[model samples]
Target: MRKNLLANVLDTPSEPRTDYARRGASRSMRMSIDEMAENAKRMIDGEVIVSLDPSLIDASFVSDRLTDDEVEFAQLKAAIEAHGQATPILVRPIENGRYMVVFGHRRLRAARELGRPVKAVVRQLEEIAHILAQGQENTARANLSFIEKALFAQKLLAMGQSKATIKSALTLDDTLLSRMLSVVETIPPPVLEAIGAARTVGRDRWEELKKLLAHPAKAALAAEVIQSDVFLSKEGAERFTHLCAQVKSGRRAARKPAEPERWSGEGIQARFRKSGKTFSLSLSSADAGEFGAYLAAQLGQLYDAFKKEKAR
Candidate 1:
């Protein structure tokens, strides 16, 4: 099922680009033929475009934006102002006939700013499909940075979408999804936002950051650094480096482990110990081996219950 969905996403049709001269499209509507064709094909395969009131559009579904690029945003605004909106955004209808954007935030922003009607394609989509369309569209455009994509994956999970749904949306395998989620879940949103997309940064560096932040003191320092003027002055990769340096500057030795927890009831006794993120459980006494075997056999059931608990 996921394979089919992914294939459909990859082959999604696009809207054909209208000729500027023929359509009286703005001179600012500058795009290569190949780009235009690709956009058109994608639109054709995806959905039909229609002009709608900008006031009726909402950006509430946006969860992946890391930062706003003023200059780039201005350029987009200018193009839209001059040529009118060329490409339509995707939207899902809401209650009372309102619509929420699934993607094309910049275009939506420009439309709102210009006080003109925005072009959009309205589709009925479930949460997973909505996110998948957003991710795949931005991916094809090479717009979303690594961290932004990671954050989007995190957002999907927070919304109670399963890991499998996230994988399908982002086109990530288990290993990559694990790495991405690790960074997004561990690093605070404010810190990630301050770092601002860090387009050149990759998984390894983010993994390093995740480890550095494992220390509460370093994590606190990082939180402070992200808000500092010095941190704000830097761009993308530099911003990430600056924060990393501050967090790594003075590391302390690891703390001693806490005493193992003890539990006893009836003829059973159990010991639980924690070291960092890992935990261990052990049984002792005459029936200890047999009890351990029983527990081990029930591990699958335990895990299923844990998953159900988490889902709730």
Candidate 2:
């Protein structure tokens, strides 16, 4: 039988005693930094595994993972019921004699629902260290999809974690981290949530979707697609594909572009239209037309000013 485990708190620095002499006083202070580093390493290593009643541990305040689907949760619960929880979650003690989870939220939920004790490793962790362990563990497990990881990166940034810290926590290089952040930041959060995690979708597809969504009217259409019954019927990856296809088709339909909008004020009239990279404006009516001619004659000066304004 596995024995019940107990937590051992790491030692903290103590005040230097005068009887020991002044020579050793600075030695303890110098060890402080090294000691802190060691403690953090121990926290990540999960040095102690203890069992706690599920009710005593609170879920992480900001979960790093998306909500598990009912079918997935049921499968996990069944496996744990049969084999017992094979993995121990990591947690930190919090106020009111409770603990906050650092990772393994799905296991925690299963244990809670089953009314069983959850095996966990209790560690004293700074917030950054906790998140770093949490992210790295998930990455190693290979359970999070690409977009899920992107959203996690976005959440870490929102919580004010430095870019360096986030890169370290996710075990990503600068370029990959930049791509993840860009994808998450470009896609609207609600739309992402609605589509769920696109397990089969990768970074490049999402980038393409972002570019397609830049159309001024595509946002409202994308929002409607997620809410439609058709969208909900499909699996996560399918849902993402469906929305992208619809939006891209919508862009094609808009390619013809509409005629110029006409405006009239004070007996002066103008027509404005944009085609590809070019814009055209046609002026008419008695007063404004002649003013338009005079303005046209100064095109050289106007073009110079426009170029200077763009530089500024």
Per-model TM values vs. the true structure: 0.63, 0.65
**Deviating ranges (above 4 Å) for candidate 2:** 1-46, 251-312
Clashing pairs in 2: none
For all candidates in order, the CA lDDT equals 0.82, 0.82
Best by TM-score: 2
Clash tally, candidates in order: 12, 0
Candidate 1 stretches greater than 4 Å from native? 1-46, 60-62, 251-312
Q: Could you give me the TM-score of model 1 versus the true structure?
A: 0.63
